[model samples]
Target: MISVLFAILTALSNGAASVLQRRAALAVPDTQTMRLSLIGHLLRQKVWLAGIGLVIVAAVCQAVALATGPISVVQPIFVIELPATLLLAGFVMRVRVPRGVWYGVAAVTVGLALGMASAAPGGGSTSVHGAVWVPALIVTGIFEAALITGAMSTRGNPRAALLGLAAACGYSLTAALMKDAMGRLDDGGVTALMTSWQLYATAAAGVGALFLLQNALQAGTLVAVQPMLTLGDALISILYGVTLFGEELRTGWWLLPELVALFLIALGCIELARSPLASGHAAPPRRSTRVT
Candidate 1:
């Protein structure tokens, strides 16, 4: 329950940050994208700075949630971030909420509820078993490398999908590492937690994921990036929870509802991503030299 609460807080904070960041991104020139100059352009805007603050808050909340609960329980909650982002965007833009967006929100909310109830995910170790880290890191590295390679060979939506998948993998890896790092606190102390290699690895993985996500967003439409990101993170996190942390979930008959729920969530994410407000395209593209 502690995990669930913090996870919700993290999702809401991240959703709010995304809306602020999108507004800032929309106000900037397209030429600045995928470049270091983009950060400089954004820093001039108060909205973007506020967004960065919220991002830090979300990261702290996420760390708390991962430390206290099973990864399966914590990660799936983030599926709501997309719907929340769009809703916040609509409000910020002073645009009326579209009927389709309402429907998508309902679908995602219901699907997430139904899925969590059906799966009843729980009972995972806080830390991975001994000697498992080596193989896990090796496989994850190879997988990310392959995705990045594929992304380089493609353009547009294809590239976005590949990069999104890679980002998903990175985020999942971060969560696993974070949990392991936090587990050290129980075993030793704060010093042990700070000294753990998992602590440093978690930061590295998070930065890598953020970088891939930025490129993915810039590569193509949100429709291509959002679904892969939404679903991929949930699925990959579940895999990590089960394989690395020994988390358990209902199987056999329960699989039916879980699959159905994932489909609904995916549909909702696609619909939400298609909205102009959600894509930060509702406002006309205006590149102003002065930001005030």
Candidate 2:
């Protein structure tokens, strides 16, 4: 029960962070220019920086939640952020969200919930040393290089999707490294934070990833980019938790349900891609005139 509560809280925090980030992204109108200069403009925006700070806090909370809960339990709950972010955009931020996205949100939420409910619990805990973390970092670097190239080559939504996928992978691996560090922490919390270079590296990577994600969001629709970003992050994190952290299915009986849940998640992503919330300044209407 404690694990369930913490998982929900983590999901909520993540949802709020995504909403704020989206708002900040939408606030920046699209201007065709060199990518490096655009990034500089984004970095200078203090409101957006605050949104990034919120996401950082969410990531930290997620690390703490994973430290205490089974991966199966934690991963599914993270999916809640998808719906929460969309709803926040439509209702709180007063952005126009299409019906297709609402359907996608439904599919993702239900599928992830079913998957979590049916997933097998971890068999046992496992730990790894900091020295073994280098390869993961390299993989992340390669992934970012590929994503930036793709984003530069593609146009419109495709570029955003590619960038979001890259960000998702980076965020996933960073979380995995963070979990590894958490498992190895010493008694003194502050000392543990100071001594672990892996944690600091993971944090830096996450920040870089977020910068990419923000650029993607600014360049594409919320519906197309946000769901893809959230779904990819959830799936990758679960995969890492199981394969890297040694988490497992709760029972043999759960395999089918988990598969079904994943199917639902895929359907959800497709739905979200059909249409997304519009971003950019609303244009002024023409003045009324009498016929002559």
Candidate 3:
């Protein structure tokens, strides 16, 4: 229950962070795309700094959730971030969220509850053999590379979706590394935690995730990216939980409800993506000063 609470809080924090960070990123000059200098510029923005602070909070909450619960259980909860982001973005942009959007949000919330209840994921081993890391990393790395390449090769919404998918992969990998690091901490002391390769790997994956997130935000509308980000992370996290952490979800009779829940969630995502809250409007043009 504690882990579940933490996971929900993490989703809220991450959703707010995404909105704030994207707002700041959109304000940056277009010429800064894909450059390390982009980070330097964003660092100077107070809004971006606030977003980073929220990101740190979200990370801490996610770590606690992962330490206390199964990865399959914790990661799926993050899908709420999509609805949360839309709400936050609407508030920030001073746009009223339409009634239809609320219906979509309701679908997402209910679908998530039903899906989690039906699946009842449980029993995971955090400490896997070192040999497991090689194949897992290699396959994930290849997939992420493909996503990044696809993102860079396109423009507009397609590019944003691709980058968002890459970011999702990076975030899922980071969560796995974080779970391993927490397990190391439990087994060993502070020294072991500091020395664990998983700790450093988590940090690296986090940085990569942030990089992809910013790029995705710059590429197009949040509508184009958010669904891919949320769904990709959940699906990839499930895969990681099963393969790397030895977690289990109910099968057979439970599968029917799970499939239904997934359909509802997908329907909600489509509706939310089409909502006015997600299709952000352009800012009004600034008036020019005339010297007579």
Task: Report every candidate's CA lDDT.
Answer: 0.91, 0.69, 0.87
Sorting all predicted structures by lDDT, with the top scorer first, yields 1, 3, 2
Lowest summed lDDT window (length 10), candidate 2:
276-285
- Residue 90, model 2: lDDT of 67
Q: After superposition, how far is residue 241 of candidate 3 from its true place, in Å?
A: 0.6
Instruction: For candidate 2, write residues 117-192 as lDDT tens digits.
Output: 7875664353454455566556657877988898899888888888888878777777776666676554446577
Model 3 over residues 134-198: C-alpha lDDT tens digits?
99999998999899888888899999999988999999999999988888867787787789999
C-alpha RMSD for every candidate: 4.1, 5.5, 4.5
Clashes of each: 0, 3, 0
- Which of the two candidates, 1 or 2, achieves a greater lDDT against the reference? 1
Clashing pairs in 3: none
Instruction: Please give, for residues 1-292, the per-residue lDDT of candidate 1 as tens digits.
Output: 8999999999999999988988898889989978999999999999999999999999999989999999999999999998898889888877778899998999899999989999999997999879989988899999999999999999999999999989998898898899899999898889989999999999999999999999999898889998899889998999999999999999999999999999999999989988877766676435579778
TM-scores of the models, in the order given: 0.90, 0.71, 0.81
Model 3 scores a C-alpha lDDT of 0.87
TM-score of 1: 0.90
Ranking by TM-score: 1, 3, 2
User: With candidate 1 superimposed using the best TM-score fit, by how many Å does residue 40's alpha carbon deviate from the native?
Assistant: 5.7
Output the number of the TM-score-best candidate: 1
User: Least lDDT summed over 10 consecutive residues: which range in candidate 1?
Assistant: 279-288
**How well does candidate 2 score on lDDT at residue 200?**
79
Candidate 3 Cα misplacement greater than 4 A, ranges: 19-50, 91-94, 149-159, 217-221, 282-292
